[model samples]
Structure formats: C-alpha cells, structure tokens
Target: MPILQWLTRDEDTRAVRSVPYRLLQEESALSCGDPDAANMLIHGDNLDALKALLPFYAGRVKCIYIDPPYNTRSAFEHYDDNLEHSKWLAMMWPRLELLRDLLAEDGSIWVSIDDNEVHYLKVIMDEVFGRKNFTSTIVWQKRIGPDSRAILGAAHDYIVVYSKNLEAFKATANKIPLREDQIAEFQNPDNDPRGPWTSSSNFSAQGFRKNQMYKIVTPGGAEYYPPEGRCWVTIESEYFRLLKEGRMWFGRDGRGMPRKKTYLKEREGQATWSWWSNSEVGHTQESKKEIIALFGASNTFDTPKPERLIQRILHIATNPGELVLDSFLGSGTTAAVAHKMGRHYIGIEMGDHAVTHCAPRLQKVIEGEQGGISKSVNWQGGGGFRFYRLGPPVFDEDGHVREDIRFPTLAAHVWFSETNAPWKGKGKSPFLGHHDGKGYALLYNGILGDRRPDGGNVLTRSTLQIIREAAAKKAPTFDGPLTIYGEQSRLGPTTLARENITFKQTPYDVRARR
Candidate 1:
C-alpha cells in the first residue's frame, strides 16, 4: 500500500515507541458516586494517558470515538485548534498508534473531522488500520443553513469508520431502526393476511439464466413476458410457488410488471447508509445548546459535539457494559452519552475542563438529571467514575528510570516492551507473565528485599533459580526460554547461553525518550 508521507514522517513514525510511560494518580476526593463503577475520567495530556491505560485495557475496549483538533486555524477558548501541517501530523500519528493498540480485535473506531484535514487523515488511517478494513466515510450534515463566505456553502462534516478486523466486525454489527417515514412506506394495501407490506422489483437486467425468462399469467387471465432486456428474478418453478402463495404483486390494473410483496413482520430494520442529516441526528446549534444546558454557560467550548450524535454512534457500535473510550474528552459529551446508554467509559482530556466541565457534568448524570441523551436513552442514572491525574514521567531527563516507580508499574512497562502485549498479571513475583510461548520476568523495586540498584535488581545465578522455582509453581508445563529485564547481569555469556536466558539492562534498555 502507498503511504502518506509528510515532512516529519520519520520522526512521527517512531514517536509512539518513544513516548515515556506515566503513572495515573487517582483523586478519590474529586470522584463522585459509586467507587465500584468501572468508568474513568483522566485529566492529563492524552498521549501519556493513552500509554498509561494500555497495561490494563489493551484489547479490551469495544468502541472508541474521538473528535480531535481539526487543525482549522480557528482559535477557541480551550483548544488552540491551530498548527503547522507537519506539526499536526506529528501530533496525531503517535496517538493513533496507541488507540489502535487499545482497540479489541472485533471493535471499531470512529473519528470526526472536517474538510481541512479529512483527506490527509484518511490516508494516514488507511496506513495505520489496514486499507482492507476501511468501512465507509459518512457525511454528517452539521448545519441547517449554508455558509455565505465561500462560493458554495459547506454544510456537512464527516465521520470515518474503520474496524480492527472487517470480518469480525461484520458478525456483530447491527442495523439502524426504521424512521417513521420509512415505516409509513409499508401499508396493508390489499388486506393480505400477512400485515403491512411493500413492493420490490422482481426483474433483473442481466438475464443471465435461460430459465429466468419464462412467461407469467395474471389472476385476470392476462399473459406477460419479461421486459425487452430483462428477465424474471426467479426460475419458473419458484415463480409459480410464490404466485400460488400470493407473494407476487401486479399493478392495480392486474396486468403490470410482477413485483414481490415484502411483509413488515419479517423486517428488523434498515441497513445503515452513508448520509446522515441534521434533522435526523443533530446540528451545530443543537450541540451548543446541549453544552450550555450541562455547564450552564455559553462559549465554554466552541466545538463541543452533541450527545445525540454520540448516542447514535454508540447505538450501532456498543452494547450494555462494554468498554467505550474517548481520548479528546472536550465537553465530555462522549462519556455522558456512554454513561446514559449503560456502557462503561474511559475519557481523557488535558485542559482544566476535565475537572471544571467533564467531571461535574458526570456528577449530574449520576444524580439522575435528565439532559442531553438521558431522556432518549431512558437513563434514570446510577453509576460512577473515578477521577485521576497524570503523575511524573516514567523516565527522567537524564534517561534514568524514576526511583519512585513501583514494581507493578515497571513490570507492566517491561512486559509491554518485551512482548508487545498488555501486562495483565499482578507481578506477584519476578515472573511477570508468559506470551508467544516465552516467559518474561522483571526484577525491579527490590522484589528480593535488596534495594541496591545492582543487588536484587540484577540477574544472577540465585535470581535465575528463584524465577525457575516460581515458574514451576505457576506455569508448570512452561518450557519456553526465559527473557529477564533487570538493572544489570552478573552472569557471563556462556552461562546465559547455556541456561537459555536473555538479559536486558534496565533504565537505558526500557525507557522511552520521547
């Protein structure tokens, strides 16, 4: 596949790998409602927050929705929304990488963007998510009126959808419910025993099969043949069967072209299409009013999306209790919608509004305030979310691992680095976890009660023996090679080779510089 290359392509390509892992510090005092709820509202730079979430959430999220900065050069009260082209691409590439990792194999991601960067974003996403996974570019009408500044008014934006695996997503995808007007189209005109019905064409233009060109006789004894270049959609035998069962329809005169009577009882809903109108979903004005109602102010956020829009997305992408995430929390519309819809959510934002705008709005949701999508989703409200702040960087300016880092945190990092999988173990011992038929172990934070950097943190004969015994107790049948990451290794190459051990020095070997 051809790639989208920009000035900072090389630098941005390596950016996600170079992002230093950070710790999440929960602020229990600011958290509201129940503590057992799995929802989270994280206040920090989103890039770092995404990295912090990987250890526990990778491959667990069912849906992700993000409304990133459009790079429109328009200044807002909270977001800059302005950056050089290359700079914007650099900022976005790494975040996309982390989001892709957090997505489950059967999950999908929806991104909202406008014309200024939509084309570029598509090319970049095609590279990140495989081109085969590209789903559709939905045109969302964001305005009821037109813009007078340009020769042609721009009234719509787009939401691009991509699935982690196209085949897997197809198995679970649902259809959109029929609109009132669509339901009106089906009526019981002939008073048939089968309820309301609609007519569908019964002819094909290809005329590929000779048996599909047979004649038809109407109830009034009128004869008919296939049109000039068309053939019947079914074979003669099947057409006779449908005719005998009263499933075939002719015009009111009883001599018109044959049609199939589609009954309403067999219909679940309509398949989704690419066009979404403001009248059906929402518009910019409605979105602004929603933000005002939640925050009790105007201009708090210039580009907040409407909760109904997110609700529509959640309706198709998620189910009750599934994990949903939004990295650009903005006015917190995505989280609010997810909560009301009964989905667990994790929202990340950098601005002060994460506290001032996002958290307080959720508190109202827990209190059963009917606003935005509450009435739509029938949310009487009873759930909670914890609030957190980003802690110090995992690595210092001098490229040394922070001394205050805990064993579990370091273990999560080492497991991710060596196996490229989220660390799900509790780090009960030096043995972190096993993946791809290999056992990974980490020696940090003096798990052996020796605090010296080169003492308990080093891989020596005794450390190896301890890990072997622990591995036997936990993963008894495991015979894979052991890869250990530590402060240092005292054992020589001969011993390492003979024991099937691979050692990586800590700090420099694991720290991410960017």
Candidate 2:
C-alpha cells in the first residue's frame, strides 16, 4: 500500500493526504425524520454521498446492490457515459473505499456489470476489498431464449458479490415465490393439522451397519433387502426408534417398505444457489413488457433494469428491514423492490434525470399506486424515502470568484478528503481564521481560495499572530496550506512559495484521470 502523508513539520517528511473520498451533495441538512429511516435518495456525485455516509453507516449496511455504468461505450445522455479503462478504475477506486467502510460487518455488496469491465472489476475488487472477501461471480442468464443471428448469444450478465471481511459477512438466504411444482410436492396424505406434507428418504448411506443387512417386509409377504455392498447411515436401533416414533412411514397398509415423512409446515423453504436464469426473473422481453405494463411501451430510457430482476437479486441477497443501498440507482428498481418487501434502502443517482424519472417511480411504489411485479407475482408495498441533491460544489467557480458559496462546503471538502482527523470548527471549508496547530484545507478547479466569510484571509496576513497574542493559551495556527489550484504559475511563482503549503488541483480534461 502507498503512503499518503501530510502535515510534515520538516521538508523531509511527506504530508498525509490519503483520506477516504466519496461524492456528496454540498447542501443544508435535509430532514426526513425517520433516523432509522429505511429509505434515502441521494442526488449528487456518488463520490461525496458515499463519503458522508461513512461516518454513520460504517460497517452498518446489511446489503448493497449497484448497477453502475457498464462501460459499453454507449452514451446514456444523462451520465457522462464513458471513462477510459484506467480512468474508470481510478473513479471506482475511491467509491469502493467508502463502500467497504459503510458495509455492516455482516453485510455484502453485489455489483452488476456486463462483459466490458467484469474481469477487470473482479481483479480490482480483489486488490482493494481483498480476494478472500469474494463470494461468487453469479452468472445470470439475462435473456431467456435464442437470438441465433450472432455467432454466440450474449445472454447473460454477472453479479459479483463481495464482503467487507471474508469472515464477517454473509448474504441471507431468500425465499423464492413458491412455484406450482414445488407446492405440489406437499400432500395431506393423513390430512394432518400441518396442512400438507412431503415424504423424504430416511435411509442413510453411513453408520447403520446392523440395519444394512436388515430386510423390509412388503404387503404380499415379499422381503425386500438393502442392495449389496451398501450400509445404512443409521443403526437398526435408531430405525426402530424412528418407526416407533412414527417418523418413518411404510405403505398405507402398514406392511410396505419404509420412508420418511417431511411435513410441509415444518420445512423451511428451499435454499437458493448462485445460478439465476432470466426466465424466472425476466429477460429483455419480460423487462420491456413490465415497463410497458406500468409506464406504457413508449416509455424508454437509454438504460432501464427490470423490477422483477431487481426483486430476484433482493430476494437472494437480503431480508426484511435490512439496509439496501444502490449507488447507481438508475431508475430506482432496487428501492422499489426493497420498499415493497419492507426493507430499508438508500439510493444514490448522479443524473438530473432523477427528479423526473427515479423520484416519480419511487413515489408510485410508496403511495401504493403502482403494481411492482405485474405477472403472477404479488408484492406487498409500503415504505417511504426522503430525497436530496448536492448544492453548489465549492467556494469558487469559473473565471471570477463567486461570493455566494458557503464556508461549510469548503470545510467538508477539506477534512473529508484530508489525511488528518479532529478538524476544528464546522462547515465544509478548510479555513477558520487564526488558531492553533491545525486548521482546514481546500483546493478545487485549479483554485485554492481559503478565507472565512469574516474577512480573515490568513495566508496573506499572519502566520503566527495567534500564537503570540495569547502567551498562556495555545491556539492552532488556524490557517491552511496556501495550495495552488489550476496552473501553479497562474497565481505567480513567488506568491505560491510564500504560503509554504501543498498545492493540488483537478485536471479539467475528462480524460485526465485515466
């Protein structure tokens, strides 16, 4: 691991600068009143919201499901749809950092991606989250049938599951909507109070050596025996005990071979495995049909996930009231299913399209005005969410200074991304006038403007004015690094060195991070 150091007293030591990064909307705190509120819709750069969530939800989330931009090189119009391979890795690196932190000790994150970045994502996840934390890369049959024109049908998508720590988290087993064939297996042969029952094999393949050679009497005096070279898993003593206890069953005539009865009411549902095919959930056809049934066939977005598909994932990955977060909420399908299932959810979408598309769809589900799974599915819908968006980015923007930006936005940007903790004062800015040993820091868009709303611009004025003012009391230097943003030379070389602080700025080109 590389070291990110800052606050070096001497020029010899590197400053600590490696802090967790996430996108959060810079805004006044919006109140939704359900502190244990199960639902949230965060609108901003995901990098920030994810960072903000770390403080409260670190190791607290139960399930995380994200369907990020697939890197298909196809534009979504709303999201800046492409990042070069390395850039994509860099962009995802920080988000993964925060995701790992916010996950509950026993929680898991499921990422949905296609062929483009799946392999690379797996490797990076292994590097950052640890390969030991890997659960499985479930191959979902994304399409039900054949479209034979192509050399091979690209009919599947992969859902990669990862845990915070290999031994810490596990996905809760989910119940599948009982199918007719499964339901039919249970019969009320004796019309027991349990409703229905299914028979199970009671014979074991080990341990029952004495019973291994025992004979079974049939209804017509025929003696049936264990096959050659095989032994019962249990002893003859236990078989007799089971038979006496009525756990074992012979023919209705009470003279046939023995079997075990599995009462339907007593059995937990079948356990789910990793394989998921599109037919049970839905493929493109089923996905589109669902959209049409709800919003009409004409409704379309560059990309939309099927609700049934989301339900399938939620079904296997979470339980009631568990937190389910979707950083790439697209159309809010995860929230929709989670809400219907009585789970708490938090969704983060960066597109302006959220207000028009994501919000409305979620509202319908909450108000019970929408049908979630339109086919033979039944969803009991009820729950709510509060919506939020990022305020303006920083204290400065464009060619000239904008006086309207608040001090808080600047402070949050500094401390959250800074290498140091125990930052003094609030708001998001790095500057709070003259103080003691530590203060705030801010550098953005090639502009490093650090000054409080009150006219204390410390860099140009005092370096140790406070330390001398109160001889008995110690005050933190209360100024920040005179970091340079944009081109270092734009602010003049002599001015840059006088501040004696580190300078950093974002590269403007969309391609730079890669």
Candidate 3:
C-alpha cells in the first residue's frame, strides 16, 4: 500500500521514516525537583517531550491549553511556516497522537487558532482525538471593533475545546469575587433564617412555554401577573415553598405577583460564555500594556495575554494540582498563571527567547517577586527543570545522516522520521548511514583524507578490516554487507561487492537548509 494513503495525490509528502518518538526514559526526570514544586518547565521539542511525557501523564492530566502555531504563514518564518494545507496537516498529525495519549479520561484540550487552518485542524482533531470527544469551539475576541478592511477584521481567534470523554468532563467553578456594587443588592429586612438575600424575577425563561404568566393579588387588592408569553422558571410547587419559607419577595405590603429571593451570599459568578470578546476578557492593547508592565519597554513579547485573562481561564477549566500544559508557551503566561494557582504545569517552546524570556518570567513568579495578585497568592520558588534540545533533525540536506547522535535521540528520530517526520528538511539521515544492530552500527565517517600521499589510499581496506573484525567478535559466521555512509565517489569504486559488501552512496540531491 502507498505510505501516504491519507493524503491526496497532489499533496507533497515528505519522505517519512520510523522514529522512536522522544519520551522520558528516566524515572527521576518525572519528579518535581522542588518538594514544594508544582510546575514543570521543559525545554525541548514539544513533539519529543510530549512523547516522553506519555507514560507518566497518560490519562492523568486534567486540562491542556496549547497555543499551537496558528499556521499563520506570517507568524512562523523560523519553522517552515508556509506549508500548503496538506503539508501542514502532515506536520500536526503525529504530535496530536502523543497529546491524546497524555490526556486524562476526563481531561479537556483547548487549542487556539485563527482561520488559516481552523477548519482543517478541526477535521484532523476529530480523527486523532475522536469526534465523540468534541465539546465546543469557544470564540475569543482577540481584537476589538473593526479594521475596515477585507471581509472580516480577523480580530478574533478561536479556542477549540475537546474532551477525552464528554460524559466525564465538566468545567470547574468560576468564582468572581463579590463587587461592592453587587454587595448592596443584599438585604435581610425580615431577618429570615437564611443569611443575606437578593430579589430575582419570579419568572424564568427556561421551558416556561408562556404558561407561567400567572396573576396573583396583594393585600391591597392590586393584582399582577408576569408579562405575556413569559413563564416562571421555577414550578408553582417550589414557588409556594419559597413563600412559606420567606425566601420569596413581594412589594411593600406583601405584593402582587411574588418574586424569588436568590441569596447573593450563596451565588457564584455568572456562568461562563463561549464567546468572550475583548471587553469580557481583554483586548490586544491590554495585552501590550501588560507586557510593558511586566518586563518594561526593553522587552516586548509578540503575543502577551493579561494575567487576569488567564486567571479566568484557569478558574473555569481546572483545579489546583491538576496538570496543565502549554505547548506554544510564548511568554509563559499559562505556566506562570498555573504555577501561581498551585497547579502542576508543563510548558514547551522552540524559541531561544523561551530561555531569556519565559524562564526568567517563571522564576520571578516562583520567587513571588513582583506584586499584583501573584505576590498576594503567597507562592514560593521551588521547582526546577532540565532543558534539552532536539540535537539535530533526522534528515540532512542531501539524503544522508547529518551526524551520529546519542542513543536516545537517535532512537526517537529514527522512529518519527520514519513514521511522521514533524520537520520539513532536505533528505538526509542524522547517522552516518544505516547498518546492522547488536554490534557496532556500520559507522563510516567517510575517509575525507582520500587523497593520501602514499600512493593512493587504503581507506576501503581499513574500513573493511574494521567491519569484519567488529562483526567477527559478535557473530562468527556473520559476514553481512558493510553498509557505509559517504559522499558518492568520495573513495572511488570498490570491488567489495563480491565479499557480500555494498556501498550505496548517500544521495546528494537532498533538500538544502534554509
């Protein structure tokens, strides 16, 4: 079968190879360095780190919030930002696989994206995370009013929500602090058994079916009924109980149609809405002001979200100690917020700025240095993280290994490059070349000293002797091909084919680096 059966024929398929997806192999690597630590700062390729995180976090995380690249061609020039639709799909498929493995059965994943790839991402997510798990596409107003150009102002971004299991997932409570103005609404003039209270409409719009346009008479013979076509939210049985319990309110002298008393003391904030505009949360301008406040004019992160905004999200989505992840950890706002709230967090970034910007920012949060709500929260510094790079990409410019890699990275790169190569690169292997395992891998750093002074060169003779001796020590009768990696024609033609030896040159036309 064709390897790229999932893609259209026109779609350019980067050659795929098998990679041993990067996953953490060390048990100690999973522990919070600080006994008091609650968050993680992982500095490595997310694709690899996510894979490494699987064993420890699978079916364990409560919520995941990733600001993955929007595939905004303009936003990511450093990574191959301008992928054709199919190519971009190719890019995300595998990472989603690992992410799914890490999600708890009751977990939720919130992805942020714009129009460039929203629809496409939805389809792919359905396939990877299961359509049954889909929750809602919460719209966030990233910008305010109109730009007055092109069809839409492109002012909004979307937060795509998906659940590991629909029946099992529920958003956490969002407790908006009581405001001074709202506090005035409370009163207990009659001194009921319950504490403070507030009056609410006797009618409710839900399933009222206009039957609740009920009329009742006050002591003064004045009669009142709900407006036409409106009905009470509560049933008559419950309404009467409230009246008997003094939980119902009526005008001056025990008035006309009664209203229910919704005790302000008992109520939480308003229910969260799916569509959040800048007014509800914040605007881009607000985000800019925050950047200036935190790091000053000297530092400016491309997309900085307000701490309060993140607080709202954290409040709605998860509880303390639950794991939260941010793969596109731009300025580390998510991690910083999660940490301050005492939730376990993992943040991944591919930029150097993550170190200079995100690391320091998080360290500051840990120390509880800056004021604001963060300081008031009483967080103390503790947790630590080890930063790792992806070493080198699997494929080189020309179809050959860029260089030999350490054991773990080599295993992961080999697996993914073969399965779902996340990176777009010229065809080349990171190893010198492929060879039999169990013994020394057929490593031939091609004899660059081909033009030796002593009458030509003995590079092939030396290499052949090395391979035969290495294999002889392991398997006496094992005389296989000496698969060597080298520039074509570097060592001239060899007559080793008769000795069960093959020397295929690394292809020279591999994709070049940017």
**Cα RMSD for candidate 1?**
3.9
Each candidate's lDDT (Cα)? Answer: 0.86, 0.60, 0.60
Indicate the worst ten consecutive residues by lDDT in candidate 1.
201-210
Candidate 1, residues 1-514, lDDT tens digits: the string is: 8898899899899988767677899999879898889899999999999988886788888999999999999897898988887888999899999999999998999999999999989999999999999988999999888887878888998999999998888787777778889899998877889999998966555655788888888876688888777787889999889888988888778877788888888888778788998877888999988877877775468877877788888888888899999999998899999988899999999999998989999999999978787786788979999999999887787666777788888788777767667777874689886898999888877887685744678888888888898888779999888898888898999999898888987766776523
Writing each residue's lDDT as its tens digit, candidate 2 over 1-514 gives 3332223222211111133233344222432333345478888778777765653455667788988888777776666768767666666666776787678777888998889989878887886678888988888787767679878878888889998765655445456666678889878765555577776664545433664667666435656566555665456677677666556666577666567777766666666567777766666666666556656656656556677778877776677778888898876778777877778888888887466666777767755645647223455344557777755433223322233433443343344334223224443233332324433333332123333321232322232232123322323333444432222223345655664544454322101110
Candidate 1 ranges with C-alpha deviation above 4 Å: 1-5, 148-151, 189-195, 203-205, 218-220, 237-247, 250-256, 396-403, 426-432, 441-514
Q: Per-candidate TM vs. native? A: 0.85, 0.66, 0.65
When summed lDDT is taken over every stretch of 10 residues in candidate 3, the lowest stretch is 422-431
lDDT of 3 by residue, 147-187 (tens): 78767678788888888887777644345555477788888
Candidate 2 residue spans exceeding 4 A from truth: 1-38, 77-84, 165-172, 175-177, 190-195, 206-229, 251-257, 293-298, 374-382, 392-514
Using lDDT as the yardstick, the better of models 1 and 3 is 1
Q: After superposition, how far is residue 259 of candidate 3 from its true place, in Å?
A: 1.0
